[model samples]
Target: MPVAGQTVGIDLGTTNCCVGVWRNNRVEIITDYHGRRAIPSYVAFNETERLMGDAAMSQNAANARNTIFGAKRLIGRKFTDPAVQSNMTHWPFDVVSGPCDNPIIKAHYKGEERHFQAEEICAMILMEMKEITEAYLEKEVKNAVISVPACFNDAQRQATKCAASIAGLNVLRLINEPTAAANANGIDHRGCEKNVLIFDWGGGCLDISLLTLDDEIYEVKASAGDTSLGGEDIDNRMVDYFCIGICEQILRDSKMPKDQVHEVVLVGGSTRIPKLQSMPSAFFDGMELCKRVNPNEAVTFGATVKAALLSGVKSEKLSEILLLDVAPFSLGVESIGGRMITFIRQNNHIPCKKTLTFSVCKDILPSVLIRIFEGEHSMTKDNNFLGEFRLDGVLPLASGQPQIDVTVYVDADGTVTVSAIERSTGKEKKVTVSHDKGLRLLSGRKRGHGYGTLEMYKLSD
Candidate 1:
C-alpha cells in the first residue's frame, strides 16, 4: 500500500474525470494546464495528430470517425452482450471486434490506424487526471482510491482496476460510487446511524443502492442497476426527435431529398439541439422528483467532493457504516425438469454462508449438477450463470438414506466458494472461486500486476 501522504482519491467518470487532494486541512480540486477543474471525457485525434479534450467535444461533427465518447457503455462487457450489440447499432463511432470478441474502437491518429479498448480510452482520461494532480502536488502520486458504480459486478470492477494500472496508478481501494456520494453528503452526522439510498443516474448506467451508516461502519444493504439506463438514453431520444423535425422541415421546404437530409442531420451536431428543453418535465410527470441534477456534471462533482473527504485534511466524524451490497441478481442451482432452485437471494448481506442437504433418490445416482445463476427470474435460462460444478463418484447408498451437504460462502469482496461433504463417508471437496483478474498480486509475486512490472509489459527475448 502507498503511504497516505502519497495517495490521492480519483473519480474516473464516464463523462468527466476529476482529481482531488488533501491540502491545507481541506480537500482541493486540482486544476489542469487548461485552467479547467473538470476535464471533458471526450477524446479526439486530429489529422496532423494530437490528442485533445474539451476542444474535441465539438469536433465530433467534422471528424466523427476520429472522435470517441460514451466508451463507458462497452467497458468490460463482451461484444456479444445485448447492451453492447444494441449500442453498436447506433453509435456514431466504429465498433470493431477485438480480443475475447470484445468491442474495440478504431480511429485514425496522425494518419496511423489505432485500435483501443474501452479500458484504454478510460485509462487515457485517468492519465490526464494524474497529470493534473501531480502538477498540483509537486510530487509523484502513486496510490489512489477510485470510485466505481455501486452495482458494478466483479468483471466491471476488475476492468476498472485494469484501467487504473494502464494509467500508471496503484489502486489502493475500489470504493462504491454511491458510498462515496453518501460520504460526500455527510451521512455520518457525528455518529448518528442513517439509511441512505443513492440513486445514481449517469450518462451510461443507472445504480441504486441502499446503505446504512452506524458508528463509522457503512454497510450496503441492497444494490440494483441497469447497465443501459442513463442520460445517454435521453440524448438518443432527443436525437431521434430532432431528426424528425429536420425531416419535416426539409419536406416542407422541398429543398432536398429525404436520404440526403437524413444523412446530414444524423452526421451533424443538429442532434444536440435541445428541441425540448422541457423534456425533463416528461421524465418525472407523476412522481415527486427532486430537482434534476445536471446530468453531465453531477458524478464528477460528487467524486470531487469525495476525494476531498478522504484526503485526511477534511475532519468529519462518520457514523459507523455497514454496507451489504448484493449480487445484481439472485443465485441458484439447477433442479429436476431443468428448473432453478434459488439458494441465495439478491441484496443479502455479505460475509454470509448458506448450506443445503440432499439425499440420493436413486441407489445409483452418482452425480449431482450444481448450477449458479444471478437474477430474480425463477427459470434457469432467464438468469445469468456464474458457472457450474458437478459432484461425481457418490457411493451407492440405499434410497433416501445418506445425505450430501453442500455449502456456499460469499465474502465481502463478492467471491463465492463452495464445499461438499458426504455425511456417512467423511469425503469432502472444496474450491475457491476468484473473480479478481489480478489475484496473483495477493501472493506478492510482483508489484501491481504486470503493468509497471519489468517482466510483464516489457519485451524480452
Candidate 2:
C-alpha cells in the first residue's frame, strides 16, 4: 500500500495537527479513521482510558478540569513565567510547578491522580498522528519533518524534539512555520531575485519572516513574532492588537524598506480575519497579499516537501532547492561587570561556530563560572538563563593573567555545545545545552564588578 522508506511531514499546530506525504508526485493530506483532515489539539482522561483528538474534544465540556488543550504555550516554560501566570486565569485545567520549576498538568484518571508534563501531552498527540498515518499507508512510519514557530527559542525547540523522541519519531529537521509556508508557495522556482515577506498569524501565535531567493538558494534575512498575539488573544482581550508592532519590528530587524519587498504571503487560520487580512497589505503600501497556498495546509505542504527531500525522493523539482536558516536569538556568556558578551547574534546562519577569550576576574581564582544565556539584553539578569558550568584547573594566576577561550557552536538542528578551555594548561570543559538538567542562578547581592563566589549561587532543578 505504501512505498518503501516512506517519511511524513507534520504541522504540529496550537489549535490543530495535520500530517501529509509527498506521493504520486504531489502532496496528500492524510486523514484519520473518521476522515477528518484536521484534528483538534486536545487530550483528555476518563475512568476507562484516555481520549485524543476529536473524541477528547467532545467530552471537554463534561471533563473540563482533566482535558488539556493549548499545551504548546506552556511547553519548555517555567511556572513563574508571566505567560503561564496569565494563562492560569483562563484555562480550566490545573497547572502546578514541578521540582524543576516546569509546569505540570494535574488530572484525575482511572480513579487515581496523575501528573503529565507538557512534553508528555505533546508526545501523546504526536503518537496519535503517527498511528493515523500508519493506518492510512498500511505501513510503519518512523521519520518526519516537524514545524515550529520561528520565534521559538532554543529551549522550546529542544522540548519539541524531545516530544518527537518520546513518540518514537526520528526528527529529520525542524523547519520554521513561516519558512515552510514560503516553500509551499514555491518561491524557489520563480526564476528571479526577489524579497518575500511571510505573515503567519495562527491560532495561538504570530510569526513573520523576510527571505531572499536567488538561483534555488533560499535564505531567511529576518524573523520576528509574538507568542501572545493570535486569534485566541484577540477573543480574550477584545481591545489589544500587536500586528503593527510586529510589522515595525520586522522592518527594523531586516533593515529593508517596505517598498523593497517584492511579494507578501499570508498563512495561518487567523489570517482570515478581515482586519488582519488588510494589515499586511496596508503595511506593505497596497501590495496584494499572495494567497496561492491554502492557509490551512501551507505548513503541512512545506513540511512534506522537506520530508521528501530528506528521504532522497527522485523528484526533479526538489533536487536543486537549498535552504539556509538562521538563529532567532543571540547566544553568549555572562562576563565581568554582569554584562552579556554575545558571540552569536540573531539572524546568523546556522551550523556556525564562534569563540571568544576572556581573562580571570579576580587574582588566584581557581575556577571561572560560565553562565550561558539567550536574549538581546545587555545585562545578564535581563536575559534568559540557559545553563552554567565551571571551568577548573586555571593557572591560579593574578587577575587578567589566565586566558580562557569560550566557544559556542550551534548545529543545523539548533543543538548548542559550549566549551571552555585554558590556553596555558590546555584544560577543557564542555556541555550540551539541551541535555542540561539544572541551572545555576545568582542568589546573593551583586558585589563590586566581579561574579560572586560559587557558594553564593543556588541550584534550580
Candidate 3:
C-alpha cells in the first residue's frame, strides 16, 4: 500500500462518533463545533435546518420525537426484524416502514413529514466529524477506516460502510470496536504472548473479546455480546435499585452494600458516574474501578492506531501490526423444520467457506427459502435473523428427491456470498447477502470441521 493524501479513522459508535488522524507523529482527535473531541451520535430536525451531534442532542429533552438516536441499531435491518420491532416504542420518534421494507425514522420538520433511513441519520454524524477534521487539519480528508461492534454481521457492516460513503469518505476498512481498543494500547508489542480480555461496555452495546497478543499479530479467540445491553442498562438498573434502597431504608435502618472484585477497566461516558467509583467498593468485593484512560476518548485513540496502520504511516511502536478476528456468532440457515443448520460457528477465524446439500420437502416445488441467522441457539426463534433469500427455479421433483446445494463463502472484508445450485437442472442462483434479507457477511477459514467468517485485518506489505 502506498501513502496518498491525508487519511483518518473514525469510531462511529451508537451513542457517539469521533474522528482521529495520524498527524505529525501522533494521533489527534478532531474537536467538533461544540469544542468537544467526541460528539454525540444524535440527529434532530428543526423548522429551518437539521442539526447533528451535540446540537441535535441538546434538543432531545424538549423535542425528543424529532431527535433521532440509535440509528446504528436500525441500520440494514428490515422493518420486520425482531430488534426493530422491540425497539419501535423505545424512542419518542416515529419508526415506520420504507417502500423497500427497511425501517425509516420519521419526524415532523417544519410542519411536514420527513423520513430518513438509519444510514442517513448516521451519515449526519459522520459528516460532522469530517468537517471538524478538515477544519482542524486545514486540509481535506476523504479516507477512513470505521469501527463497528464485533458482533455486527454483514448487513450491519455494509450499512456502516454506506454511512461513510454517504459522508463522502472512502472507507478503507471496517474494523471491530474492541479490536481497535486493543490496538490503541499497543498490546502486541510485548515479546511474550499474553491472553487479555476487552470488556467493551458502551452506551448501546456490551461486547467482550478474548484476544492473544503475539508481537505484531493479534488473534481473537472468542467474542460474545448483548447488542442491546450496555451503560444505559446500568443506568436504569441503578435507578431501580435506588427505589429499592429507599423502600428498604423506610422499613429498616439500612442494608449493607456487597464487596468488590479485582481489576476493572472502564470505558464510555456512562462509566464516569460518581456512584461507579464507590459501587465497585460496595459490589466488587471492595475493589475499585480503574479509569486509567479517559473513558470517552479511549475508542477513538485506538481507532487512530488502526488508521495510522491502514494508511501506511510508520511508527516504531505500531508499524507492521496485523489483526485476526473471529466470528462473533455462528452463521447458518433455517431448516424446513425451523431448526438452525449452521455452516459457521462462533470463534472460527475469517475468510472461510462451507457447503451443504438439502433434500426437498415437497414434490414439484420450484423453490426453497434459505433464511440466514447468527447465534449460539439451536432453534430459529432463539437466534438472530440476518436475512433470507429464495433459491427458486428448481426442477420439479418429488419429496426428498432433489439436491439443492448451498455454498456460503465469507470474503476477506467479511462480505458473505451465497450460491445455490440444482444438481439436476444445473440452474444456479447467487446473491450477495444484504439485510432487506439477502445482503450481509462473516469471514474466516476452518478451525476444525467448521470455520468462521470474521477476520480483523492483515497489514501486508
lDDT for every model? 0.59, 0.83, 0.70
In terms of TM-score, which candidate is strongest? 2
For candidate 2, lDDT tens digit of each residue in 1-461? 22346699999988899999988888899999999998888988778777889999999999999899999888778899999899889899999987578787888866767766677678788988998999999999999999999898888888888778767789999999998888888733557888989889888789999988775778888888887666788752331347777777877888888888999888999988888888778878888989889898899998998888888887777776887888888999998888999999998889789998899979888888999999999998999888899999988777876499999998877778899999999999998888334122211212422222222211210
Question: lDDT: which candidate is best?
Answer: 2
Q: Give the per-residue lDDT of model 1 (tens digit) for 370-426.
A: 666656776888866666677777788887875688787776545567777777676
Model 2 residue pairs with clashes = none
1 or 3, greater by TM-score: 3
TM-score of every model? 0.69, 0.91, 0.77
Q: Candidate 2: lDDT of 270?
A: 91
Model 2: residues >4 Å from true position, as ranges? 1-5, 187-189, 235-241, 435-461
Q: Which tens-of-lDDT digit does each residue in 318-429 have in candidate 3?
A: 7668788776668888887789898987667787899999889988887888888877789988987766778778888789874899887776557777778989878888
Candidate 3 least-lDDT 10 residues? 452-461
**Superposed Cα deviation of residue 198, candidate 3 (Å):** 1.4
What TM-score does prediction 2 earn?
0.91
- Give the CA lDDT, 0 to 100, for residue 91 in model 3: 80
* Position 65, candidate 2: lDDT: 95
